[model samples]
Target: MAQASAPSGLRFHSQIDYAGTMKISSHAVARMLGAWQAGPGPAHQRLSDRLRLLVLDGRLPLGAALPSERDLATALGTSRTTVGAAYRTLVEHGYLATRARARATVRLPHATPSERPAGTESATINLSFAAPPAPVEILHAAYAAALEQLPRYFERHGYDRYGTAELREAVADWYRRRGLPTAPDHIMITSGAQHALGLLARTLLSPRDKVLIDHPTYPHAIRTFAEARARLLPVAVGTCGWDTAQLQAAGRAAQLAYLIPDFHNPTGMCMSASVRRRLRLACPTIIDETMTDLALDGARPEPCAVHMPTAVSVGSVSKSIWGGLRTGWIRATPSLLERVEQARPATDLGTPVVEQLATAVLLNGRQTERPDALQHLRSHRDALTEALAEYLPDVHAPRPAGGVTLWGMFPEPVSSRLAAIAPDYGVTIAAGPRFGVGGAFERHIRLPYTLPSSQLTEAIRRLAQARLALTQGATGTHTPAPVA
Candidate 1:
C-alpha cells in the first residue's frame, strides 16, 4: 500500500514514499462518526468503539490515512488526549498502524479462534445475504448437461477474456426476450454483478469524479465506487420513491450514475414504468437488474433499457437461480463492451468455464425462473413480514413487489448497536448503515427472506430478545463481520 503525506502543519516525518495513498479528511470522518458519543462508555472508549465499527463495516478503507489526532479531536469536539488514547487503543488491537509522528492508518486485526463470537458454531440464521437457494434438480441437470458439451472447447486455450460464446448469446437472448434488442457482441460475461460494477468503475471513473447513486443502495456498490476514489452524489429514495428531477439534476454534473430500479436492493421497491421512461439522465447510467426475476406480485419487469436505450444493464442469476453459480454479464454497446474486455484482464482473466457452460444451459432452458421457486420466495417474504409484525411490532417492513429483501425501519436509531449484539442471539443481520454513506440509515436494516419460513420466524424471535436486551442497556461486546 502507498503511504500519504501529512496535511500541512501536521508535523510528520517519514523516509517512506508518501504519494498516491488515499487520506480521508477530518470533517468527512466526523460526519461518518455521527453520534459516536451516544453509546455508553468513557468518551475515549465510545469513540474507539465507533471508529472500530467504521473500520469493521468498511466505511474506513484499510491503509487510508486518518486525520492527525489534534485535527480529529478538534473535528470531533473532544480533547486531544482522548483522541490519542483512542488511536493507541486501536493500534493495540491491530486495527490501526502508526509510526512515530505519522498518522494512523486503518487495518484489520489478525483473526484468532477466540475472536469468534459465542454461538457462532451453532446454527445461526443469516439475513445478511439476499440470495435464493439452489433448485437441486435443475442445478445438477444443468451441470451434467454442461459436462456433456464441455469437450468441444478442449482443443483451444481456455483463457478467453470474453466468456464462452454459448453463455453470451444466452444472456443476449435473455434481454431480447424482455423487449431489449441485444446481440452477443454487446455482452461481456463477468464473475458476478459486483465484478461488472468494479470493472466499469475502473474503466470509466477518474479520481474524484462524481458518481450519482441511490441513497440506501447496495452496500458493496458504495464500497466499489469509494474504492475507485469517486465522489458520490446521493439522491434519496424516500416513501414516495425516487425524484426524477433530483436525479437528472445530479446526473448533469456526475460522470456516471448507478441505479437499481428493478427491485432495488434492501428496499425492494421497483421503479414504476412511468418513472423509468421519464427519468432521463445526462450521464451514462448502469442499471442493476439482479432482482428482476424474483417478482412475487406481478410479471417480471421489462429491462430498463427498453425505455432508456443508452443505459447499460448488468444482470446475474445469483438471485434468480443460485449465488454459488457465480455467473453474470454486462449488456452495453459493443464499443463499450470492447473497452470492458480491454480492462478485464487487470482484474480476472475470465469467469470459470464450467460455470459459464452451466449458466448457459440454465439460461437457454429457462430454468432460472421456476414457478415453485417464486412461490416459495413469496411464502418466505410473507413469513418474514409477519414475523416482524408479531415480534418487532414497531418496525415497519414494506412488502416488496419483487426482490429477496425488505427494508425494515426501526422506531429508533439502534441499527449498528443492534447488529453488534445480534450474533450472540443466533441471528446475523446486515445493518442499515452498511448500505449508505455518511452514517445514514441508522434507523433501518435490510432483512432478507432467503431463509426458510421457520428459520425466518425463529430469527425474528431471537431478534426480539436481542432488542429487549438492548433496551435494558445490555450492550454486547462484539463487532459485526462484513456482509455481502
Candidate 2:
C-alpha cells in the first residue's frame, strides 16, 4: 500500500488505497540539469545548490523520492562520496529526508511546522506551464556580456521603441541562419513573444476581424486575440499535426492567422515541410518560434516564412533560454513594423535596454541550451511516459519530437475533475480546456515534462489518486486558479 507524501512530511492515510511508491530514475535527474558544468562552489556544495534551486523553483517538487547516492553518482559521472555529501547537505538544510534503505524524499525548509487544513493538504507541485528553468551558467554569462555593452547606451535616454540596433541586428542574423533572410529594419523587439503578439493584434486587428488560430492553442494567444476583439477562426491540431487544407480553408476567410509550425506548444508536433509549402494562406500569418530552440529531435525545422515568405515570424528566448528575459522580436517589412512601433507605447515605452543587450549576446554568440537540454528533455519525456503507463494506463500520451508538453488523452472527461481534486493529492495539473476555446478537449490534459523524473513520477501518482477520488464521488469539477 502507498500513502500520499506531503511537502511538510504530513501523513494522513494509514494505508495507500492506490498509487504505488515512486522512485526517480537517475537519467531523469541528469536531464533536468543539462549542461550544468562545474560552478564556483565545492563539488558537494555545487550539487546541493543545483538540487536546492530545482526544489525551490518547483522543478524537483516536494515529496518526490530521489535515487540512491550510488545510482546518482554513476549517472552524474561523479564519486559516490561526493553524491553522499551532497545528499547529507540537502538533508541538513531540510531539502531532503532520507532513511536507511529507502530513497531520499524532497521537502522544504520551514521556520515552523505548518498545520494541515481540516480536510485537505496545501498545494505543492505546479504542472500548468511546460517551459523549463534557465541554465544558470549561460544566463549569467549573457548578463555579464550585456553589462559590458550597457555603458554605451547609458548616455542615451534609452526609449527604443523600434528596438536597439544590436538586438535588431541579432534578431535578423538569427532569421538568416534559420533560412529566412531578414534585415535589421525588419525586426522590432518587444518585452517578449506574448508582448510582440499583443502589439501585432493591436496594430493588425479591427473589431470583429476574423483571425485564424489552432483550436487547442496557446491560452494567452486566445486571450490576446479576444482582447483585440478579433473573431477567432480556430483550426484544430491533433497528435499527427495541423490540417493544412483546413488551415488554408480557414485562413482564406480571416484577416490574419496565428501559427506555431515548429515544435508546437502542447502537442510537441513539428509541422511537416509539405504542410508549410502548401500553407498558401491568403491572409498574413504570424509564426511563433519561441519553442524552436527546444528541439528534442536532432533536426531543427526552418522558419515558416522560408516556405511562405508572406508569413511573419515572432520569436523570443523565453522557451529556449529563460522566460524572465522578456526579450523577443517581430520579423516583418519595415513598413509593417512602423505601424507596430507607433502603437507600442499604449502597452509600454520599450523593451528594457539591458535585457535586449543580454539577448543579443546569446543570439549573436549562437549560444543555446538545446544541445544540453535535448537529452534531458528526452529522458524526462520517457520518464513521464513510463509513469503515466504505470499509474494511469488508460490515458494515452504521445511522445512528441520536440517542444515541452505531452498531450494526454484520457478515456473519460476527467481533465477538469482531475484538476479540481489534484490539490487534495498535492499536485496541480492544467485542464485540457485551458488550452482550448469554448471549454473543449475535456478528455485531454497537457502534462509538462519540465519537472524532474522523480517529481513527474510522484505527480502522476497524485493524478491517479485524484482520478480515483473522482470515481469515489469527489466535489464538483470546478478548480479555481492558483493564488500565486
Candidate 3:
C-alpha cells in the first residue's frame, strides 16, 4: 500500500495505491455504516460493533486494509480520536491488526463477545449472497407504526390469500408511482418475489410448456419453472445489453417469458429504451423489477411492463428495503389475478397481515434508496471492480449503474472449481453454473457489491488466494455462516 497526503486540516494519511494490496476509499466506508450514522450509545462502541458485524457477515472479507483513522473519521463526520478508539477496540478484540506507520487490516477474532477470549481462530467467509442489511431504525419505525393499524385486521379471517386490502392498494400505488397505472384488483401480494414466481408458475404453466429466460438468469427462477415441469428457453444477455429481437423471437414459441429489464440481477445490465419499445412477445410475460429501486446512477427507468400492458410484473422490497420483509406482489389483469388467488390456497391460506401492514407502510412511504445507500453501493461497486482488476486482471467485470451484484467473466470454466476451493481460502463463492442450466455459464460468476467496500476488497483478495491454492492442489472444507 502507498500513502497519500491527508485531506487538508486532517492529520491521518490516505492509502492511494489500491491495485495490489486491498484498500477502500473513505467515501464507501460511510455508506456501509448505514444505521450506525449515529450510535444509540457511545460512538466508539457502536462503530466497533458495526465493523465486527461486517466481518462476521462476510461483508468485510478478512485481510482487507482499513482506511486511516483520520480518513474514516472525516468520512463519518466525527472526531479523529473517536475513530482511533474504535480501531483500538477492534485490535483488542482481534478483529484488526495494526503496526507502527502501517494500515489496519481485517481478521476474524478467535473469540466473539459471546465466547470467552482465547486463541485466534480461522473462519470461512460466505460469498454466496449479496443482500443488503436492513435500515434498522427505519424498519423499526415502520413496524412500530404498523402496530397502530393491526387492530383493523382483527375482524378479517386473516386467511385471505389475495393479501390484505391495504397492502394491495399500497402495491398498486407503487406501480403507479413508477409510471405504470395499476389497480389493486390487478395486484396480488405474495410471500416474496420467489413465492410470487412459484405461484404464477403453478397457475400459468402447464407441464412441458416452454418458459423464456435470460441465458444467465436468476438461479431460483430456473428452479421454480423447472419444478412446474416447464422446459427452459434461454435468450442471451451479454455485455452489449439485451437483444430485443432475440427475446421477441423466443417469445413466439414460449408459454411465458420471465425477464429483468431494469437492473437485471447477476448481470446488472439495463435494456435500452428503443429495445424496450421494440419488444413484442406472443406469450404472457412475467417481468421482475425486484431490483428497480437500487439504481446508483441515472433516473429510475420505466418498467418494461409499461411497453406491454399485458405483462405480469413482479416486485418486492428485498433489494430496496430489506430481504427479510417477505412481501412481494404480482401486477397483471384482474381476471388473471383472480385465477392466481384460486390456485394459491393449495400452497398457503394467505400472507401474514402484520408483514403486509409493514410493507404497506414501506411502499406507500414513497421511499427511495437513502442517499447514503446509493453512495455506499456505488463505492462498493467501484471497490469490487478495482479489487478484481488488481487480483484477477484477466477476468472481465463491468461497472454497473445500479443494483448490488456484478457479473464477472473468466477466461476458462473455472467457476465451479473456484467455489469448491474458496472455503479453503477462507471464502465461499456462488459458482457460474449456479446461475445457469446444463452446465452453462462455466466462464461466469456473480459478484455482489452489497458488502462493505473494505470487505469487498478483502473478499476479492481471498478469492485470489483461493485461485492460487487451487492451482497448488488446495482442497476445501465448508464452514458455518457468520452471525453477529
Candidate 4:
C-alpha cells in the first residue's frame, strides 16, 4: 500500500501525528471566518486578516490545528491558491506554524519592543472589561468594620468550605430584600461569581453535557462551559430581548442552563417580570445576579428565582462595589449546597474570612445600593452614548438601562478588525465575538462605560478613529492593548 501524501499539493518534511491536538474542521473554520470576502482587500489578504483577528481575539485557540488548504478552500468556496496564500501570510506573520506534512497550528507572534504599548498614553482608556472602580470611602469603611470583627474567627480553624455563618445570612438577606425567601443554608461562599460558576459547572456537568446559554452571553461563561467539554446550545438574544418560545424550545434537551437575566452582560437588558413569570425550562438553571444592584432605571428587577425556584443564583459585589473584592456566593437548595461543599476541597479551602466579613458588612448596610454610585453610572452611561452619537454616528449603540456596557452594532462586520487596531488610537474594546461561540456577532462590540465621563468620551473618539481606519482598509501600525 502506498503511504498517504499531504493534502493534494502540500508537502511536509515528516509525517506528523495530530492525536491529541484540537483540529478544527474545514466547515467550522469557514463558519468562523464569516463574511471574510465582504471586507475591502484581495481575497487572500481578506481571509488572512479575518483569520488573524480570530486568533488575536481568542476565538481560535493557540496550537489548534487548522483545516488543510484544499479542504478549507472547498468549504470556503474559494480556490486552493487563495487558501494557500492566506496560510502562507499567517505563517510568515507568526499567526500559524506549518510542519512538512502536518496541518498548520495557531500561534501569536512574539511581540518586540516596538509592539509593546509605551507609557500612560497607551493606557489612556479601556472599554474591554465591564467592571466598576472601587468606592474608596465605602470600601475603606467596610474593611475597617471587618477588621473590628476579625477577632471573632480567631478561635476556630480557618477552613470553611461552607463560608462564614454571618456572611451566608447576609447573602440570604440580599435575596430576601428582593422578595425571595432564602436561608443561611441556601448560601455558600466562593472567591467570586466566576469562581462560583466554575464550582457549579464542575459539580453539575459531565463530559458532553448539553448546556443552554444565551447567544453572545458572558465570554468567560462561554469559556468555562467549553473548557468543561460541554455541548453549548445557544438561544439568540436580540435587540428586542430573549424570545421565550425559542428559549423554552432549546431548553427541552439541555441538561443545564446558564442565564444572565438580571441586566444581562454585554447587552445589559433585564428580563421583564412578565417574561420571568412565563419562562420555564426543563433543565436546572444558574442565574447570575452580579449586576442586580446597578439598576439605573426605576427599580431593581426581582430575582429570577422568584419565578423559577429551582434555579440557582450566583452573585458578587465585583460589579456593584469593586473588582478588588473577590467575594461571591451561591444561592441554592440545601441539598445542592451540600454537594457543592463536598466538592469545595478540590478547588480550595474556602472564601477569605476578612473579605467575607467585609462583604457581610457591605450587604447588611446596603452599601451596594449607594445613590451616588448609581447616579455616576447613569451619567457615564449617558456620556458614552452621547459620544457614540457625536463621534461614530453610523454605529448604533443603544443605552442600556443598567449594566456598564453599551452593545454597539457597526454598519459592517468590523468589530474584530476594530479591536485589533483600536489600541493604536489609544483605546481598547471587547469585540463582539468574544461574547459568543464560533465567530458570531462580527458586527457588534461591547463598550463599557465604567470609566469617567471624560475618559469615555475620549475612548469613543479614539474608537471612532480606529473604526474609520478599519473601514478605509488601512492596515496601519499596531500597538498591543494595555493588559489589565
Candidate 5:
C-alpha cells in the first residue's frame, strides 16, 4: 500500500526509508525542523521545547506514533542522547507516552472539552444525581393503597393549594418521630424540596437581600436565592465541617440563611447540634433536609429545625424513597405556611394529588427496612473512597457518616479543569464552584457514589487519569490552540 500523505499545506514526500524495513516521512522531519528552529537555547532544552511546542500545536496529534529517537536525532541534526532526553521530558510532563511494543506516541496532557468517554449513556451508570433507589416493597404497596383511595379524592376539586390534611399530618408525624415538636397545621406540601425553597425565596427575599450559605452548599439553593435577587454571603466549610462562629456572624448580617443540617449535599457533613442552635437564633433559617434519610452510618445528632421555631424545615421523600414521587413538605408556623401558599400559585397549582396519596400511604404504613438498598449504596461509597485513597492520596476527602457522595479536594486549583476532563473518563463530576455561593471551592470536586460498585470503580479510575493529566504540566484544555 502507498504511504498516507500529510494533510494539506505542508511540503513533504509521502515516505522515505530509514533503517531496513523502517520508513520515515518528510512531514515528521519537517515538524522536527520547525520545532528546532523556533527556539534559542542549549541543545537538549531546545529539543525539549520544540517537542513540547509540536505536541501543543497539534503538529503531532495525540496518540500519533513519533519517529524513533535515533531517527529523530538524524533528521534534526542532534545526538541520540539529546533526542532521548527530550522524549523523556515530554513523557514526564504527560505530553507523550511509551510502551514495549508501541513507539512513543504524542498525547495531549489534558482532555479536550468536547471529548467524552463511552458507557455513560442515560440508562447506564448515572452518578450525577446522588439520590438512592426507592424501597421497592414499601413503595409498591403505597402505590397500590393510593390507587384504592383514588376514588375518595375524585369527588373533591382535588386541588388543596396549601396541602391535603392527611398528607400534612403524615409529614408532621415524620418530624414527631425524630423528636421535634411539629404541628400538622404548620405543614405545607410542595412538588419537591426545590419547589419549597423557591416558594420561600419568592415570599421572603427582596432584590439583593443578603442570604448566607456554606461555601460548598447545594447548587440549586444558590441559584434559587440568586434568582430571588438575593446577594449571597458564602462562609467556607472545611473538612471538619462549617465554621459555626463565622456562620453565625454571617447569619446575623444576612436576611436569611439556607442550610442542609443532615448529610449535606456534596460534602455530606451533618451539622453539629450546637451550630444548628446558634444559626437558628442568628438568622431566619431555611433548612433543606433532602438527604436526611440517607444516613448510611447512623441518625443525625441534631434535628435540622430543632432550635428555632421561626425556621422552616424542608422535607422530601425524593431522597428517602424515589425522586419520581415528587412529594415534599415544609414544616413551619401556620402563619408562614399561609404566606408560602400565597406565593405558591405563581409557580405550581399544588403538589400532584396522586403522588401525595402515594407518599401518604408510604408514610402511614409499617415501612420495611431496606437492607439491600443500603448495602448497595454503602458498597459504592466505600469503593470510591478506597480508590481515591489509593490512587490520589494527596487529595483530601472525608468519608461521610452518610449521604451518597465523596467530596474531594485536589492539591491544586484545578476543579474546573477536572470537570472539563471528566467526560473523557466516562464520568460527569460536579466541580466545587458549582456548590459554592460565589464561585468558591475551586479546588474541590464532588463524586456521587450512587452508581453500582463496578461503575464507581471505573469512574474513580478515570478521575485519577484525568487528574494526572491536568497536573502534569501539559497545556490546559482551556488554553487557546490551533484547531485541526
Candidate 6:
C-alpha cells in the first residue's frame, strides 16, 4: 500500500509547474487530510499543526509538492507572510523539505503527540450532531429511584456487562410494546447506538467486506464501518423514502446493510412497510430506531423491524428521553444475540450498571413525562419550517411527518460555505455533505428543532441574515438582525 500524504495549510488546490516538467498542487494533499479546517490555535500554529497531521496521518504522501506560498495564503484567507511562517515551522519540525527545485515537498517525522490532528474548534451552530438537551430534573429523579433499587443487587456481582437480566427483559418488553415480539434472550445492552454499531462491525465484518449504507445516513456509522476496514456502498434514498431498487442492488453486492428506517438522520424520511419487507428479503439488516419515538405533529409510528423478522433493531433513549442515559440495546435473533454477547466484553466489558438501572427505572414508569420538553421541541420545529419557507423560499424544506430536524436544500452548492459561516451569528448548523458519503448533497443543510422556541427563533433569524450576507459576498463580522 502507498503511504499517506502530508497536510497543508489550505483547503483548496493549487497547481505548480515543477522543474519545467510535471505540474503539482496542494489539492491532492489537502484532499488526503479529508478537507479538515485547522483547529483553534494561534493562526500560524493552527496552520502548522494541520500540516503536520496531514503528513503524519499519511494523508500527504512523500514527494508531493506543497501549494505555492501565494496559493496557500489565498486558500487560508491569510497573508503570504503567514503562510511562509507556517511552512517554516513545519520545515523545522521535519515535516517538509525545501528542495532545490524551489517547491516544498512533504516528509514525515517520528510519530509524536503533536502528530494528531487538533480537535475541531469551529464556533458554528453544531446542528451536525442531531442531539437534544437532557431533561435534567427528570433524569435526576430516575437516577435517585434507580439507586433505591441498587441495594437489592448489592450482594451479587454489581457489574454485569451483558446487562442486568432485568434491563434486558425490560428492553425486550419495550420492543414487544412497539409491535415486535422480542425476548430477553435476544437482547444485548450496549453503551449507545454507536457502541452497538462498533460491536457489530467487529463481530460481523472482515476487511473490505461491503457494507451498504444510505446516501444521506448517520455519519458516525460510516466511520465505524470504515474503521473496521469495510468498504461502504451508498444507496440513494428517495424524497419519500428508501429507493428499493438501489437498496436491492447494494444488498446483492454487500455483506450487510445499515439503515435508519425510522425518521432518518438529516432527511427525516422513514421507510414504508413495503420497502422494509424488500430490505428484509435483500440482506441481514441493522435497523437504527433512535428517532422512532420522537414523532412530532401527531405523526403515526411506522416500525420497520416489524416487517423484517431477521433484522437487528437498535434503539436508545438518547433521542426519546435523554442523551445522558448512555443506554441502548440490539434486538436480534438468539443466534446473533449469543455472538454479540461473546463480543461485548472486548469493547466495554458492558454498558454501565448505574445508567442501565436508571434507564430501567424510566422504562418501568418511575419518572413522569416532561410535557414542556416535547412542546418546546414541536414549536421549534414548526417555527424553523415557517422561517425557512419565508426567507429561503427557493430552498426545499420538506416538512417531515415527524422528528426534530428540518432538511433544507438550497439553490446553490454552498452548504459547506454556510456551515463555515453560521458560527458568526451564534447559531450552528450542519452542512448536507456531512450527512452523506463523499461530497454529494452539497445543496442541503440539517437544522435541528431541539432548542427552546426562543432560541430557535433567534437561530432562524441569524440564518436568514447569514444567507443574505453570503449571497452578497460578505465575510467575517456582520451585525445580526434582532429575532422577531
lDDT leader: 1
lDDT (10s digit) by residue, model 2, range 409-428? 99986666577567667777
Stronger candidate by lDDT (1 vs 3) = 1
Q: Quote model 3's TM-score.
A: 0.74
**CA lDDT for candidate 1:** 0.84
TM-scores, all models, native as reference? 0.89, 0.74, 0.74, 0.91, 0.72, 0.74
Show where candidate 4 strays beyond 4 Å: 1-22, 113-122, 476-484
TM-score of 6: 0.74
Q: What are the Cα lDDT values of the candidates?
A: 0.84, 0.77, 0.76, 0.83, 0.70, 0.68
User: Which has the greatest TM-score?
Assistant: 4
Model 1 C-alpha lDDT per residue in residues 328-398, reported as the tens digit of each score: 98999988988988998888999888999999999999877788898998999999989998999999988
Candidate 6: residue 176 Cα off by (Å): 0.9
Please tell me which model should have the higher TM-score, number 2 or number 3: 2
Query: Residue 401 deviation, candidate 1, in Å?
Result: 1.2
Which model, 4 or 5, shows the larger TM-score?
4
Per-residue CA lDDT of model 3 for 1-484, tens digit only, reads 1111111111111233645556655655664454564535788887876666555433345777888999899988989998999899889978899878878988866742332112212464556777888889888988988899999878877788788889999988877888888888888989988899999999999987888888678888887886686777777787788887677767887888999888887888877888888777999999998888888888788888888888898988888888898889889898998999899988987888888999998777755457787888888888999999999999998877688889999986666667655665666778775565544565787888888887777788888877776667653323223210
Write model 4 residue lDDT over 370-478, tens digit each, in one string.
9999999999998988998999998887768797788899888877778888777777787787777657788898888898999999898888777776667665324
The true-versus-predicted C-alpha distance at residue 13 of model 4, in Å, is 27
Off by over 4 Å in 6: 1-126, 297-302, 366-373, 474-484
Candidate 4 vs candidate 6: the TM-score winner is 4
lDDT of 6 by residue, 1-484 (tens): 1111111111222333545322345443434334344344577765675566445423345666788888777755678887888899989877778976467887765544321112223233445456788778778888898788888888986667568887898888777776788778888889887788888888889877878887777867877886776767777766767767767766777788898877788777777767776665466788888887766655445567777678888888887787767899888888887887787777678777778888888776623234565677777788877777776778888887666677888888766556645666566666675566545566788887777665566667677777776788753311121110
Candidates ranked, most accurate by lDDT first: 1, 4, 2, 3, 5, 6
Q: Report the C-alpha lDDT of model 5 over 365-425, residue by residue, as the tens digit.
A: 6241255666777888888888788778888988887777788888776665566555555
What are the per-model C-alpha RMSD values against the true structure?
A: 5.6, 19.2, 19.5, 6.8, 16.6, 10.3
For residue 205, what is the lDDT in candidate 5? 92
For candidate 3, which ten residues in a row score worst on lDDT? 2-11
What's the C-alpha lDDT at position 272 in model 6? 71
